[model samples]
Target: MNKIKLVLALVIFISFTALKTKDDDFVKRSFDAATPLYTSLLNLTGDNFKNYPHSFLPNGTVKYYQIDEWTGGFWPGSLWYIYEFTREEKWKIAALKWTNSLESNQFNDKHHDIGFMMYCSYGNALRFDNNPKYQQILVQSAKTLTKRYSPIVGSIQSWNQRKSKGDINTWEYPVIMDNMMNLELLFYASKVTKDDTYKNIAIKHAEQTMKNHLRTDYGSYHVINYDPKTGKVLHKQTLQGFSDESNWARGQAWGIYGFTTTYRETKDKRFLKTAVKMADFFLDHPNLPADGIPYWDFNVGQAGYKPDWNFDPNRFKTTPRDASAAAIASSAMLELSTFLNGKQKEKYYNAAVKMLKSLSTDQYLNTDKANPYFLLKHSTGNLPSGREIDVPLIYADYYFLEGLLRYQKLKK
Candidate 1:
């Protein structure tokens, strides 16, 4: 009996060791893959730092965007993550060069995505280096962002009203679920400046978003239009989902990430509870794939979820899955797990592990040298607009690296 028990114990030890080695190998592989991919991107973009790698086109060519675009920061942010993972000086030099290129956007208040632009870049810089210069840039960016906030609307404006392609401008003051992400800049500024104004605005915006943007089931609307003068909700709609009422996968992921950050910064139970609900809603949805990736929108093929404007029943099977959303949610869930205990924490952590595993596979990870600059594939940017239908996105790579780093830290 003693000999049998010893053999069983040895088997368990070997199994655990193999699992640990496998997990570590995944992180190393991801870092190894990213190092060369980004190195190639830096060489391709060569000296013209203003143009950032955005995505791959359907023709398999790399698409670049100017620094002012919302996704510009993600490249630099990914560099920072690579730096953190590898501790290589070359990545640090590259990250600083790419990050400093966007310093001029500290004054850009045209959109709420300034947070996505500046925070993801300079914010990571601050995290890794703790430079006073990065802090100043972030504080100024937060100040600029505050200009978009209205006392009546109680939220930051996401986009300026504009006409495009013969479409009339009907939205007076539109706030999006994406705006929740910008509040982090404000929260950081308040902490650094020791002024309550920034934090106050962030809290109010979060409160209003919780009040208006969330459904009874905790699914988020992509956009919420408000009357600029009276604070009345004029319309609840979507600019990127299958339907105005559908749960856009990336939007849900954004809500989960944003609220998790909010709860981390403020330690507010309400935000914590809301984050949990949003995560649960996404994870528990029947339409979510078994591999943990979700379709571009949860209601794309479902009955009663078709868009009233452009319905296409034939597009059901071809609906692209968003690996970006899975990456973002995985990163968020890893953090959210730290705040819980017992089975809830285990559930979130295990789900995050599942997502990371799925994303690391060749099915999702970009293994083809034909498009080696980008990381993950099959991310749908804007399906209704017929843009970037199925391609590798910069932010997808950023969040995927982030999720891996977060997972690595938790495992340690």
Candidate 2:
């Protein structure tokens, strides 16, 4: 019995030492990889308002600007997040310049992604700066967001000019799963302005997402149709991924993070429950690779379809999985882990650490200085023309930094 006890003690010590060694090695590698990225990011920020276009380019040349794309939020948001982490004055300068360029969009009479486009940039800037002028910008942006609330739908319309597309009017006020995330701005506006309308709007939107976007098993679809006239859910589908019923990896990530954020703001049992469901779906999905990274589409393994035979030459036929999803999930898991206790927290923290460690070593972390960008080999804007196919993407880098910061904060 003494011999057996001694053997068990030895095994436990070995396991503990191995775990500690792995964690220490990961911290060293992550810090080393981020150093050059941190320096280059500083230089990029120092170039000031004149050099950067509306958004940052991977190669540091911003000759072209994509004004209407969803990616517009990432640059300034990234700058703001980076500044918060690094406390570098140069990052603030770059972010302020980007924020200053969005005066018209904040007050635009239209209502499509004002939360995503304006709040993430200007609102975050206000959070970082605490300047009255930035506060005013955020307030106006919030009012604009409040105006988007539709009485018919009890939720904000996700896009505009949907009916003007003639026969394509079948898409009725589509409230995507992605929109669940945008509700954060509305919830914040409620806190800032002491207004119940903003809070109500955010909760109503989340309830709608729960009713429409989520499946019985908690897997969520990307897009859902709402009756613009009656506010009823018409259908739910995966617009960007394999099919209407198939899971999109990133969409699941959005649901995981979005629902968790909703829980954070509301402390509502429903939101927390939904978050757990989504978390379980994400971690238990067999489609994910052993390394914790996921394919661009979760249904790719099951989808017996081919890309259009006349596919564009620029787009690769093969799917290069997205590193951004892993980054985003890692960050979200850290946040979600904090909200849980005991075994749940341990499981989530362990999963998050493993995913991040995998990302740190995978093709995602491009330490090559000639490239300049830290996180590479991402698949953003991969659909349609296949704009950014298996290349270094700015958002991937942004999320990687954000994830690292979140992980570091959790450790401390």
**Which candidate tops TM-score?**
1
lDDT of 2: 0.70
Best by lDDT: 1
Query: Model 1, 1-412: lDDT tens per residue?
Result: 9999999999999999998997778778777877888888888887798789999876767898887889989999999999999899998988998999999999998788999999999999987788999999999999999999999999999988753221534788989998998889999999999998999999999999999999999998988888899999988876788888899999999999999999999999999999999999999999999999999888886888857556566865676899889999999999999999999999889999899888888888876664869888888898888788778899999999999999988888
Check candidate 2 and list the clashing pairs. none
Predictions in order: lDDT:
0.89, 0.70
Give lDDT tens digits, candidate 2, residues 141-230. Answer: 677877767877877777663532123347777777777767887787788888878788889888878887888988878877788788
Off by over 4 Å in 1: 1-15, 163-169, 315-317
